[model samples]
Every structure is written in C-alpha cells, then in structure tokens.
Target: MTTTPDPGAAGDDRRLHPWSWLFVLIGSVRQFLVPLLVLVIFGGRREDGVQLAVAGVAVAVLALLAVWRYFTYRYRIEGDSLFIRSGLLERSLRQVPFSRIHNVELRQTLLHRLFGVAEVTLESAGGSKPEAQMRVLRMGEALALERLIRHRGHAAGDATAQAPEEDAQTLLALPTAEIVRLGLVSNRGMIVVGAALALASQVMQDNLFRRAFDFVRGEASGYVASFDCGGPSLALAAIALVLLALALLRVFSVLLALVRYHGFRLQAHGRRLTVERGLLARVRSSVSRRRIQAWTLRESVLHRLFRRRSLAIDTAGAQLQGGEGGQSREPPELAPIATPAACDALLQDLLADAAWPPRDWQPLHPRAWLRLWLGDLVVAALLAAALCWHFGAWGLLGLLWLPWGGWLALRHARFAGWHVDARLVAVREGWWSRHWRFAEIDKLQALQLRQSPLDRRFGMASVWLDTAGAGAASPPLRVRHLPEAQARMLYVDLGREIARRRLRW
Candidate 1:
C-alpha cells in the first residue's frame, strides 16, 4: 500500500501524531543525558542538594515543553508553500516554498517502526538547520507529504489522489554478504576502537594506557610462569594476542556495517534517486540527479583484495544541513561495495554521456617522479635529523623510509593521469590506495593553478578543480606535478569552458 493525498484536504492544517510528545521527550532526555547523569551522581552529597533540586526541575521543564510544543505546533500546505505556525509566548510563522526545498528526509527508529510513524525533516540550501521538522507523523501521512512536495504541489486532477506504485524499479540492492565485504574493506573498526580508547582516556581518572599496559604485563608474566615459556615464546604469544584483538575489531566492524546498511536499496523515480537503509533506525533520503556536483570512485588495497569498489557522490545542499546529532555529513554512497564491472555499469547508466573509464588518460610530466621523490627525500631527511638528536647514530636507521617513498613516488607518477572530454573532466591518482574524482564541466565552480618555490624550481605546477558540496573526506580533483606549460594550457582551457557553461547546481 502507498500514501495517497486527498485533494480536498490540501488547505487544512495538520498536527503530528498524538505520540509526538513522547518522541520529543525521549530526544530531549538523550540530549541532556550526560548532564543529568552528572547531577544525579553528585546529588547524593550533602553539600549538593541544590543540584538534585535543579535536576528534578529540569526534567519536569523538559516534559512540559515537549507537551507544549506538540499542542502548539501546526503546519499546512497553501498553494506551493508549506506554512508552519509554532511557539506560544513568542509566536512564529514560517513559509517554505516547495521550489526551494532541496531535500526531504524520513527517519524511523525501532520505536517509530513499532508505532508505524516516521520523523520528517524538510531541508533547503543555505540553511544552518532543516527548514522544518515534524517530530512524528503516521507513515502514510509522511509519505503523502513527501509525494506532495516532490511534485511541488502542482499534481493535476486525480494524480495527487492516486497511490504510488509499490513495485518501483530498484537500481541497486545490497545483500548481507556484500555488507560484510564492505566492513572488511573499510577501516571503520580501527576508527571505532580509537574513538573508544580516546573516550575512555577522557572519562577515566587514571592514565588509561598505563593501566592497560600494566594489566597486559601482569597477564603475560602469569602466562609465562604457568607455561615456563622462553622469551621467544612470549614474543610469539604477544603477536598472537595482537592478531586476535584485530580480528575481534574486524568482527565489530562487520556488525556495525550490518546495523547501518541492512537491506540497503537504491531506486530511481524520474530525475530523483532515493536510498533506504538501516537495521534498527531506517532512513529514507533522496536527491535530484541534477543536484549532484561531483563523483568519486574509490578502491583501497583492501577493496582490491576483496575485488570491490565504492562510488560516492556529492550533492549541492548536503553541506548546509551540518548533520546535527552525530548524523553523517557525507552525501549518501551510490554504491557502498560493488565489483569493478558493476561500478562501471552503474556509471554508464547514470552518466551515459561522459563515457565510463576513459581510455585516453594523459600522463603528467615525465619528470614528475623527480619532483615527488624530492619532496619525500626532504621529509625523510628532516625526520632522520630529529631522530638523530634523540638516539645518536642509531637513529640514522630512520633513513630506511627513503627507499619505500621513492618506490611509491615512482609508481604513483607512472600511473597518475587526467582525462577531459566535452562533458566531463576527471583525475585519478595513488598507487596502493587509488581513487578517481570527476565532475561534469558544467558542475565546475572554480579552477586554480598553484605553484610553490619547489614546483617552480622543478618547472611543474598543479591544477585544482573545485565543485559545490565537495566532501572533506573525498580527495581533491587535482592534477599535480604537471609541466608548467601543460598545466597552464589545461587551466586556461577549463577556465574558458567553465565560464561559457552555466553551472547546473
């Protein structure tokens, strides 16, 4: 079954689900959990009776506010704008035009699912926060509102009254096995472990590392005493333990991936693409195809080992939302984990004109390896000097980095290349961990040609292409260590093309 809007009820004001106050209360409590915990822990002290009273008052105030908000908040659709009236003492009315809305997000937690409701957020460009957020709405009502907004409130005759098709064509659907591969390819486990360690260090009064090291040492000493093992055996045992810990972390990562991306599906409805995923807390989000600013295809060493790659796209209004409450700021991934051939097919289907996997990739300057190696050499030298001051002559071993750096630089320079066609400009770089960043020529917002003293000395320069909504995690679309003349030619050509074309976003 699908949501169908009633044409006659378009102008009537609507209240959220009756249980919205409960969700709002839960959210407020979560937001203040830390402060409340602190107060409760200290409240037992004879000298801190005031804190106890304050905590009690705060809880009551929050509950009252949640209920008041539910009673006061009202919204309605008037022509092409969503009109909202809220607040009791400081009354406010907001009108958000449907044309200006860029994103409509529907979130349903486990509790929300039990109640068959969803939280709706309406977002627009250049806003620090969502334009409007409905705490809770019936599943059908939320879907109906989303459909109304998607059509910009201009659906004709029976179109607005009709239900959406239940069997819409799905572009992609990830299975549980693929999610496990994604977890294996990602360093999310390491990231989570590090964050946990950092948090523990902050929360504990003792030096967390010192305590951990002491505990490990005690356990190792006991094991050695019990087994009567030699130093070599102890060393092997330590290595085994380390490996086991890493394995456990990988398992944790797999569990996390399953929880976040379970039943992940991507669907296309006309010019818009929608993604729905999550195990405990379902999220449904969509972005217009035209709002996509840049695209990235990433393949790390692990990804290559698993025969997988991921494709991510940056959309125009994503950066403005700030992703409040620990939510992801990164734009949704088009493909979290897919084979090379699958990735190529998706790109071909989505961006047919640009040509998938350009064959005519132009290499950078022949001497680019020299420039890359020189930079690495200087860094190695500085590190060696710093170590020598601390460890005397023994520290010269730090120079061992030179050979590895030189090899990497040579390989990177050999493989790095750029491609430009009538519709798209793309750059690919890296050796062990590789990625390709590209965008349509019309999506290009800025072009920069940069040269440092070292670059000038090497007679080389770099060109950077900027696009709207570029994510911090994504690599810059830069062609580096190019001959001065070639760099200038590319910069001028791209600049002229960008100037001639109107930016799509």
Candidate 2:
C-alpha cells in the first residue's frame, strides 16, 4: 500500500495513470459501436473507399482525443480540498472541499485489475453528478486517496501520518452458499431474461415472436417424431421443456450472484462503514455512520423458504452520481442474504440504540380491512364492466376477482402495522413480500397526513414519513388505514419530535 502524502502541502499536481487513455478509448468505442457496425454492414457503394477512409480518420481522431484527455487532466490535494483541472478548448477547474464529501467509491473491473488500476468517484449530498471522478489511477494510489478523504477531518499532521493499515472489524462476510441462497431468493434471472429478449428483439432482423414460435414448433415436431407419441406424450414433452428452461434460468441466476457477490464483506472502521464485493469487477464503497438516512429489511416468500432476509440502507449521498456510467446508484446492501437471526443481530449491532425488530407493533384500525377491500372493489368493478361490454354474461366471471381481492385485502390489513419508539419510527406492510422501513426521528425530513374520499368514509387516514436519500423504488414509510384521530395525533407528535431533534443527514 502506498502512503498518502500530506494533504496540507501545496502545488503537488498529479496526472492519472498512463493507461487511462486506453480506458477512454474503450469507452468511446462502446459509444460508437452501433454507427461503426452500420458503416461496416452497409457502406458498399462506389464511394466505399472514401467512406472507409473517413471512418479510419474518425477512429484516429478519437484515439488522439483520448490521449489528449489523459495529458490534460490533473489533480492535487491542498488545504482541505481537492483541486482538479481538465479540458483543452473548454478549460475548467473544480475544487471539492473535504468536509462536503460524503462517500468515496473505488471500482476495479477485470481489465483494471489486470492493469493494476482503479476508478475513483467522490460523492456529496444533493449533487446531480459526482464531485470528482478520476478515470484510472494506480491501485495503491487509489487506496491512498481513499484514506486521505476518509480522515480529512483529522488534524493536518495526522492525515498523512496515520498508519497505512487501520483496524477494521468485519461485520459480515458472505460465502458461496450464502450467495447461492441470495440467487434463489432474488428475481434477477427474470430481469436478465427480459432484458435479453428485449435486446434480441431490437438486434435481430426477423420478428422475435415469430422466430420463437418457429423454433418451438420445430422442437416439438422433432420430439414427436423421435418418441412416436400422441397428444398426451407431446404435452408431457412440452412440460419437460418448460421445466428445463426454468432450471436453466435458475442456474444463470446463481452464476450471476456468484460473480457479483463472490467475496462480499462489510467492515466497520471507527465511525465509517465499508462494503467490498464483486468477482470480476470489485467495488469498495464507504459512508459515514451519520450519513445513513433510513434502514430497510426485506423478505419475500422465497426468502422465507430459505429462512433468510436481506438488509439495505439509504444514505444521504446514495443518488449523488445520478447515473454515472461506471458507478452504481442503488442503496448499499448490508446483507444480501442472511439467516433471519443473523440479520437481526447485525441490525442490533449497528443501531445499538434503536431496538431491532420492535416488539409492540400496533395494528391498524379494525375497519382497515374494509378500506382496503373498497379500493380494490372499485378497480374490479371497472374491469368487470369492461369485460361485460365486450363479452355478454360470460364477463360475470371477472367478478370472481372480488372475493380473491377481498381475501388479500383482509390478509394485508392483518399483517400491516407500525411502531414508534423514542429514537425510531418503523412501518411494515405487505403479507407475501414484506419489508420493514425505518428511520430515526432525527432523520425524518418531512411528514404527511393523507385521507382519500374512501378513507374519509371509513373515518381513517394515513401518515407518511419522508427521509433523505430514499430510493425511488423503496416503499414509502406509511402507516395506512389508521383511525383519523390516531393518524392526526401521530402526525402531530412525529412532526413535533422531528422539529425538536436536529436533522442528522
């Protein structure tokens, strides 16, 4: 490991690794791949030679630009801030103060590892983009930079004088078995399959649906010819084929999980929490304990089958990158998959103050079931009416949805609840795919009390709590279907508590 230089020193500019130009070139190629493919496939006219020459010139220009970028980009650490200067025709300089930096991310792809280099990104709160991004730096230099930022608040002399290796307590580490369990509990395979099908539809000249149907028909014909069987046998063969496809999908999911979380580890170093994971593309991200805005515990039917759950956290800088090409913006996962007991213990260890899994979960209003059922009833009635208009009395079958919806609503009402303690407020919903979302009283950014027309009829209302850095996909922290009086009281009390406490993030 390379020791970081004194950040207090001035005029020590540094350029990125020499191989950064290659990475830049690769990125440019990816952006232009489609156009290049078009030229290769269709440029066969009389001016073919001229077109090829133009393409070659363009490639050369891009290569030169990549090299130029490498030569121009420079950074230096000076007095509690990082100064960066880049661009030629569009000259610009940026200074990022250490106090404002919230997260430091290091990513290393397989190619980066081969070259002993990594990409670094510095994130801050409320930023639409990273405060600073260094394309490629020596692995040791990247670590040194991370350390420098991690201890920027320390006295100037201690920043660089600290030992290279700080004691880190490993909070969680996942083995291959745990990763496999995560694969089984996740729907990543389905997502991958959907994306692949979409890509095939766009890239293949033939109609994708037609191609699939023809392939399936040919396979069925071959199977029937080989077995010399009738409808029953053909049906069985089709079932077998479907089962085989499902098995293949599961295997793919397992492989993906293995590749992404192969050596996952979460460690605590003083007040910082660091997560390191991935096989081919390693990522190490660190966030301060005070930066976390909310916590979530997730469990699905699949998780129950495996007796496992996952924990994730929303940080103040979670969305700082805003879609950076090489960086992920998803909330950090503390445990991808762990035994329920293990997850609880980890939560207790981290939170210590707020009790993990609140014991006294207050149920919603007794008529909350009716409120839920009525909402679904309106949707089901509209659907049944649409079906009835299209197909005579046969549409009455659509009404069957009413009973099923009512049953589901009742179950959800029974399972959904909320809990409030001095330090934290927690809410849980959903019976089949349940999740518990919580945030400290000091972390709550806003509160809302909502009452729909139907809710009014039932004399019920809902309380919603907002937290900074909550992912768009995360469920709202809502206590729904509470008695109007209770909801109002809870809302006012929470608002007062939030106002009294200083916001942490």
Per-residue lDDT tens digits of candidate 1, residues 66-87? 9999999998988889999999
Clashes of 2: 0
- Candidate 1 CA-lDDT value: 0.82
TM-score of each: 0.91, 0.89
The TM-score of candidate 2 is 0.89
**lDDT for position 33 in model 1:** 79
The alpha-carbon lDDT assigned to residue 395 of candidate 1 equals: 79
Clashes of each: 0, 0
Per-candidate local distance difference test: 0.82, 0.83
Off by over 4 Å in 1: 1-8, 42-51, 153-164, 207-217, 224-226, 325-328, 385-390
Best by TM-score: 1
